[model samples]
Target: MPRRPSGINDLDLAIYGHIAEGGELTLSEISRLSGRSKGVIFRHLRKLSALGVIEVREVGGVLLASPSRSPRRVIAMGIMRAAEYPYVLGILRGLRDIYGPVRVLVYEDAWREAQDLLSGRIQLAMVPALTALVANRLGGGRVQIIGGGSGGGMGVVRGTGGSGHAVVRTSNTELCAERLGLDGPRSYFGGPGDILGALVSGKVHEGVLWEPYLSMASASGLRVEQCEIEHCCLLSANSGVADQYGKISRIAAAAISSARSADLQAYAKLVDLPVQLVESSVRGYSFHEAPDVAYLERMLDAARRALLPGSSVRDAVVA
Candidate 1:
């Protein structure tokens, strides 16, 4: 008589689940818990091994299985702005699924921290496009541009009329203001959403804001103003870790693609986030793969020329 083959359903996920949890169990132990024959457990174990789901090790003639690799670590910033957080969160979640056990670091003032991380102090970084540009220049090939958000325009909002009303903007807003040739009393907000909220609350006469936030402000019945300014987001890596750049870039791109494919109605199903928030986040926002070296060079040249004397720390690495 020939021995019977195990069915697909008999693969015994519990056995593999145990191995995934950092425990090593022998066939006899699995058999006792699952109420299956030792032969059955042994056959299932072999099948799992063949499928590359677990690794079997022999210790004193006893068989043990363990998971293959440790989880990956990822850090994300630029969350202070509501518009920016969703995409970064989506990328983090997608990476968690692909690499397992991903960690995220959120920062309101990402410009400074992003530079620090790219210098090898931290492993991963997500920052505004402007900050990425600056980092690329100062870090001298130490920073790799893995991915970035689709380009969008920023807007300037101002209260209709008020004395002592503040005018809030980004630290980098001067670049945009200079382009627009705006001269007025201004205050800097840490992030775009903060500026928008201040304008909506009548605390600021004007603010610089991004797309959906601009739309949301108008919908709120507040007197809103709009001006177009360039905006983008970036995912970068330390230079020594350039080998991982392609992998990280692909993962970031997939996250954006996946989120775009998600059902609008199911947006509410995302963990710990509201539907309106998700919708606002996905709307009008886009993702782009790694930037071309030539374009980056152009931006670097422009920054060096545009920034005031001693304002820019260094020049970006070209090539």
Candidate 2:
């Protein structure tokens, strides 16, 4: 069995797994599979279904249960406008359960998040891991990664007519494209929307982006090769906030770190994309409570070759 996340118990997880494996089962079937009494199973089923953590269907006068969607509560939490991160929805849902009423702050891009973090306009922000790294450096190392978010949501697309030209936005993505040997005069955009729009307009041969932009590009008949990139996004806290609100930071970290793929898939509808696209995009992403040093090292090496001025990944990482 997978390790139990905070708040949920081992039995809840077992029941979830059983229902998931069985596709859809009645209370009695789940009880038998779980080796629990029908009444006990029925109670848990009702609770889970009501929470939207599982789907309950009525057919032939019998209730069918399946681990379908996870529960998401509307609550206040602060977040950026970068909707490409699949785990962002999951984390917000999780954080809402903890903090109540997540208040979202939409910035033009991750760079804006970094600026807000430095100016005390935001207490907590989730941006690209590289963005957080650079922000920490810019802020004299006053920000720290309290947890990780989705990674590998970015991709490089070849233009419609198979041109070698390309465009980029994020630093990490630019590095990934360079590492992939996509040689061409690169046009730079400040945001993913511009890059995608340019790609659609035949202005650029290749565009680097994160999903659902990448998925959108592919759906529009453009070829999207998933960047073999990792650690794309991370949750960072201002050092002062982390120091004074450590418990809240931990809660937020635990919530995000515990996000499962099913949570990401369920969130697809919220983002108005096909579940398969969200599913496909996230297969390349990994969520964790801590940064992957190896992946960061690889990314940093690539960043350096692409003319990024970071001395070392370690210099940007929080202890």
Candidate 3:
């Protein structure tokens, strides 16, 4: 039996993009512009209209579609391993409480978030502080740090025999390994989400991952060789949205300053881990509103050593 379509598809996205690029488009116009058959286009348009992502109107017996205004204004918040970091999760929860159901874009690397931030694809991003610096340099210093979250959560773990065959997650971890002399074993690079699985599956004998993952792995019987590094994650915004700083800062403060133990149980559920593990993970990080210049420079130096191209750390930080 042919299954009924349930939600948005590429056809729907293309049609919406076409309409969003200009004035309202008729069904035929959307089909022609998007290069899809009329019947397929109609199905997608009907779905999008039903979902309220696009508007459908009739004029002169022709059905016309237009992009909804709300989606365009939606600020895209980018993150990785959101459930692991309390402050990152707090910022997200806080923003949604203020703005209501904002869109989130998940990426494996801060590098990708930096690219999207520069291209205006994401209005706000929660990235590694250095990644924000790299993007700031890329944007000619247009990136602004409204605040920061999740301090001191980085660490490295090794498998049996203490061989550091590792896949480090962030550039920060890479730097930590180099600084602390944990870089001896052959190392590969993976995103935070993949690091734990990689280690458990024996793809790598050692792994460097951040909170919740660190706790979860230890709970699952993997030995944690070391977890003592303390790097922060930053809340970054495009300079164009600087006027909204007052609101952003307020939301950040409310979330980070008011963090309570009860919050861990809820966050643990998101990552499908034990409340105890989540509680322990929270101890790995410090939540705060601002970061010092020297600390940011250390991160930038690491980013530079890790060879993140373009813009020295000095040029990247906003005054």
Candidate 4:
């Protein structure tokens, strides 16, 4: 039997079912459905939302209810207009949850994150593992992977079940594709989005992508095969913030690891992706601490084999 969510009583479940079936309900609709007074229904609705059994939002001065992941209190994350990291909101929430009113600057590009980290303009950033490793080397040991962000949110794509003349383009997903035996006539693109665009438009038979682009690709009829790489994204802190890196990194790692479907809703408008797409993309991310020793070694090995510009991945990690 499926385990019931805790703190939920029989009454809450019945109320939840009405919202679940109808998609959403206002206080009066739920009241009518349950044959209860509007005042009583409103009270129960508050209880259900507090228990995390349902989501409540306001639209045009009307309260609407729907099914939800057990979301914590929704907080407005003032993500910068240029921010592009899908998980940046979670990082801010993590820091705010721990330090309270901490500062988190966001950027649209990981390379910019690397540049700021090297310049000491920013103390920390969430970047791809290989990017973090290379950036650490580029900064002359000034940067370090203080914590892990997430993994397995990348993949190679090919149409018609990987048959026919495969014109495969690449992105950072190449970091592990070689080790995974993923090889083909390869070209390179600027990033996952460009690669996905080419693939979907039939300009390339294969390409690489990370979510929610990967999700978009699947929805667009492209086949996405996840690469078994555990060193996708990571958290890097520069030497300037080394003193408190441990504390901040732990909180970030925990919060980012626990990032769920509701985080998409809370951050949907900020990210400018469809709430449904972002929420569905959650399954592609497996948030956690740094990659294991072997997986880290594999990514480094692949990075080296690809002739990527960087210092030694081994030296950059600093054990």
TM-scores, one per candidate: 0.58, 0.61, 0.66, 0.60
lDDT of 2 at 130: 71
**Judged by lDDT against the true structure, how good is candidate 4?**
0.61
Local lDDT at 20 for model 4:
59
Q: Which candidate achieves the best TM-score against the true structure? A: 3
The regions of model 3 sitting more than 4 angstroms off are 1-66, 69-72, 82-84, 87-101, 161-170, 184-186, 265-277, 298-303, 308-319
Regions of model 2 farther than 4 Å from truth? 1-101, 161-170, 244-249, 261-280, 307-319
Spell out the clash pairs found in candidate 3.
152-230
Clashing pairs in 4: none
Clash count, predicted structure 1 = 5
Write down the lDDT of every candidate, Cα atoms only.
0.54, 0.64, 0.64, 0.61
lDDT of each residue in 120-141, candidate 2, tens digit only: 6566777677777777777897
Per-candidate RMSD, Å: 10.5, 13.5, 9.3, 13.2
Which of the two candidates, 2 or 4, achieves a greater TM-score against the reference?
2
Best first by TM-score, ranked: 3, 2, 4, 1
